[model samples]
Target: MRFLRNALLALAACAFAARPAMAQEILRDTESEALLQDMAAPIVKAAGFQPGAIDIVLLNDPSINAFVAGGQAIYIHSGLIETADNANEVQGVIAHEMGHITGGHVIRSSEGMADASRISILSLLLGAVAVAAGSAEAGMGAIMAGQRAALGKFLAFTRVQESSADAAGAKFLSDAGISGRGSIAFFDKLMGEEIRHGISQDDDEQFVRTHPMTGDRMSRLRDVYSKDPAWNTPVDPQLQSRFVLMKAKLEGYLATPEATLRDYPLSRDDEAALYARAYAYHKDARMDQAIAETDALLSREPDNPYFLELKGQVLLESGRPDEALESLRRANELTRNSPLIAAIFGHALIATEDPAHYDEARQVLRAAVARDRDNPFAWYQLGVVYAAQGDEPRARLASAEQQILSREYARALMSARAAESALPKDTPDWLRAQDIRMQAEAELERSRDRR
Candidate 1:
């Protein structure tokens, strides 16, 4: 246990590698991922981590945080997005996290650690939190986050190791055509936050708790950037516009209607700004205003897939089922793979009573499932679609499976035990298979008791 603890800490601090206990099923959808991919393209090529294959999971936490849990995965907090004022900053964060994976930090840590169990448990805690919060699809599995206070109770890294990660990460930024200035700037922001909070380390995020902060480190980062050619590179227009627009849309989604309109208005310079306003009005429940703004944006841009997507969402939310279907179908045709848009279309299909919806829903869901197979929510929805048209046996199985996947622990345990009867005992993936089975059981039990 001690080995695991010390190792994970050292790895996180020294090499920035993560030997995660279990991988979270969190995944990014096609539309939201487009921008992330655009931003990451430079460094991913430089870093040599299967460029398009690497997954970036967006965590739901509002705190300023980011990390690479698995060797190939990058987890960015939704709060990180809200906090980053520009695309460069977000890219810098990703580059730093990616550095950890490239460095083999976790494996290095494990090689030197003492207590394997303690390390594994601590890692499990962090992994679980990230999985629930950062999952791409709506329903993240299980809930243990209320006990975050207990998350870092095991081996954690030294200040020296953290410093190494930062130094290494800065290099990744430079190699990726981004100025390490973003790292410096981000640390600067956090340092300001620390000062504002009186450097209350006790109140810092879980990631910060393990990876402490210092002003000298920030200064060092700035010095590194002084020599980086990317420091002067201008931020791309498309990236900048998307950042603002995404932030605006997310704000509108979470904040109150008045607040939404206040932050994101229609009379902006870019097409994205217009899309943001359209979304704000949609959420504000002003149908006419939303449609008018969207149509105007369409008139200007003529064929923005994102705008079309927003139009679909607005139409659906505002009770225009048929129109929503048309818009979403068009949006899907344009992009060919958007889970959010597909999900919306599924709902719209129900309203349209179109016979084609049954198969398309399955097809869209299949695509969605391909991207995020562990998404019990998508699976559950698929089960419903199957059940709605009278496939009781398939519906029951999917429901049972989904219920298990969603944390029906006891039931999943039973199901796994049942599966065990016919399984080969020596299979290498046996443990992994059983673990998932147990998680499903746990979810089932919890849901039944509602605790």
Candidate 2:
């Protein structure tokens, strides 16, 4: 599991090649990502997007929310996953966010904001004129009224977008042949939370809110969904099973050990419970218990790559790098060298501190990074391999790759320039270094202008 918090501002920055500073930790796990992809594939395809064109990122946050922030990606908070009862609920969420993407809502949001700003400015000007005429009380009232009008206008615009997204989501679910029951159910849960938190549910509250009231959303969705043929379709058992395990795994990773153990006690012997306790034990530094839990999971499904990955991660972090290699290697093979898992496996090979493993680490990491250039961690590991082999120029190039992704433009510029000066002219590595140098310089210039 990779938690990109500080070094990576947002995975979207790398994944989408867009630099939007978001102060949220990104959670990267192979199993969760694979399952999310599987769950979202049909919905995404139904929305006319090609496979793998959209990314679903998990944020290590406790807020029950999902959003599309200027990319063909859905950012789902861990809390939302934890709150969901099944994978279908998440698919419903994904379909809604996809609606925003297809509708160009993120790009169009600026228009709404700009329109509201104009109304406010016009109101302020009229208020100033009234004040100049010696009616200060009337001017104050006008200004307040203008502010309210601007807010109402913006809120109404957003409400329309939300309704559009809701309709689009329902249509996508219908097109994908997935039941909308989960969509209505999830909204029902949101309504329950609103009531539990003492949020006003009256019609007066709807105008001030960005989204339509949960009750209203659910009512409309239920009407449309009940008429759809997929409404009574059964949930995919395998998908639901995976969702349970994923949710449990997330809870164990995010919650305190005490809470994890309390919720998933040792008495529970199910796969989900074992998965949760494995992470819980690992977090608490109970290596023996963690290994035991992982072993139990592997025993149930001997070829399960995720269980092996967990075991390898536990062993590697617990200073058992030599022991981690076999499990990680097998996990990497089973996953067909998934970039994230392969990176971890390469790290394990390097952690052995044996020269014999360095060559393999270099090969594995090089391929991993080649497949996923956005992975700064893989580039860092590859750099270590190059440095170990006394290849300073390539080492610098790798560092440049990592530094650029981490938004260290000045350091990236220096590293890329150093690599470029030393490497053979017009070679692939040289070209890459030059590209990094130019990109870094442009970013730095943009930064200076912004400042």
Candidate 3:
């Protein structure tokens, strides 16, 4: 889990330095990302996006919501994944969010707001005219009526957009040759939640809500899906299997150990159960039990990089860095040096406290950051390597990298300046340090302007 504040949001935070800004919590896991990417690729392409053009980001929030904030990204809450029965269900949600992107709804939302504002302003004018005529009660009533009307108008616009996205999603699924059964099933789950919460599906409530009634959406989607040729198609078995494991993995990581044990007991020795129990045991600080569970997984699939990564993580966190290195090194190799896993491997190498390992750590950490510069943790580890080697200039440059990502623009600017002064001019390191200094200065200026 990491906190990612957008650069613009970070600047805004700096502008309001008197109050603490809420950071957006992101869950970045290589295994989960790979699965999500594979699941979203076809839907993305079907929605007219190139492969890798659309990103599916997982948020740490436990709310059953998936939305497109802007651009070509879909943010899926952890709760949505937890609630979903299969990958197909998530795919259905992704397709729907893609509809919002393709329709430019986020950009067009200003139109709805403007339309509502016009009604509100006109109503205020009318109310003022009544007030001037000495009818105080009538003026108040007019003002209140205008507010309600504006709200209703805005909500109606949103509802229309929602319905349009639903139709677009259905078409995307059809074009992708994916089954819509999972989509309908997921809607049924949402409908159940609405009933459980006693949320009325009456006409009046529907008029005020931003979305149409859950039941109405399901009904409309069902009709459209039923007529599609892919309606009866089965989900890919491999994808379904991965989803089950992913869900279990999330449960183990997020749930209390007691709850995880209750849900997946020792008696259940399936791969998913083992994966869950491994994490649960690790969280409970039961080293022997954690290792045993991990060993069970390794026995089943020795070459599995994710399992190896997990084993390495457990070992490293338990202060057995030496024992962790072999597993982590192999995992990194297996994944072709995946940035996230390699970062861990680099950290483990540093944890060994062996000066002999510092060179290898430096190499690994450099490569990790090269592949994924957004990873502050990797940059931190790389800084550790540079500092350990007595390379002050490079160390400051690394610190600048980590600080910039962490939104510490002031500190980053200082570090970058120090690094640029010490490093030889025209060198790559010197150039990167200069870049950071300029970037930090620009962000600081933006923050000042906002203030």
lDDT of 2 by residue, 119-148 (tens): 777778888999999999888788778777
Clashes of each: 34, 0, 0
Q: For this target, which candidate reaches the highest lDDT against the unseen true structure?
A: 2
| Deviation from native of the Cα of residue 263 in model 3, angstroms | 0.6
Which 10 residues in a row give candidate 1 its minimum summed lDDT?
Answer: 138-147
Cα RMSD to the true fold for all candidates? 11.8, 5.6, 5.4
Model 2, C-alpha of 81: deviation from truth (Å): 0.3
- Scored by Cα lDDT, where does model 3 land? 0.87
List ranges where model 3 is wrong by over 4 Å.
1-22, 445-451
Residue pairs in clash, model 2: none
Cα-based lDDT for every prediction = 0.65, 0.88, 0.87
Highest-scoring model, TM-score:
2
Candidate 1 vs 2: which has more lDDT? 2
